[model samples]
Target: MAVLCLMLLLLAGDLAAFMQPPVFHPNPPTEYRTPNCAQFRLPGCPRDLNPICGSDMATYANECTLCLKIWEDGHDIKIIRNEPC
Candidate 1:
């Protein structure tokens, strides 16, 4: 009886530990950096709908966001086109 009770207590403890929420690890499989893509600029920019194609071949929301990316990430992105992709 005492042995069974001990086993049950250990099992309960194990079950409780297993039921815990998984811990979040940063960039589990691969390292990643969040892009500084923004819809609006801090100093305020024109609400132009003109999309600028980045040198990375990605179309930005506007020139403001593109400039932010360059300034923040130091990306070698340049204006490819003044239109959306």
Candidate 2:
């Protein structure tokens, strides 16, 4: 009877350990800037609908988008016209 009680106690302890919730470590938050038209020089530019021509002779969605593309690609682009080529 004592041996049976000891076995039951060990089984209960094992079951309790197995039923525990797992621990998780989440990734750290990254810093990101929200894009907009007003800040149309580089990093954060809006994806607007108005198309424009760049000095590099490339068409972009808009002035803001053009600036962003130019900034990314290192192109000498500027607002040639407020229309697509």
Screening candidate 1 with a backbone cut-off below 3 angstroms (N, C-alpha, C), the clashing residue pairs are: none
Residue pair clashes in candidate 2: none
Once fitted onto the true fold, the runs of candidate 2 whose alpha carbons sit more than 4 angstroms away are 1-38, 41-44
The per-prediction tally of clashing pairs is 0, 0
Writing each residue's lDDT as its tens digit, candidate 2 over 1-85 gives 9999999999999999999998642532243223334565567656668887666657777777776775678755656566666
TM-score of candidate 2 to 2 decimals: 0.45
TM-score of 1: 0.43
Number of the top-ranking candidate, with TM-score as the measure: 2
Worst 10 residues of 1 by lDDT: 27-36
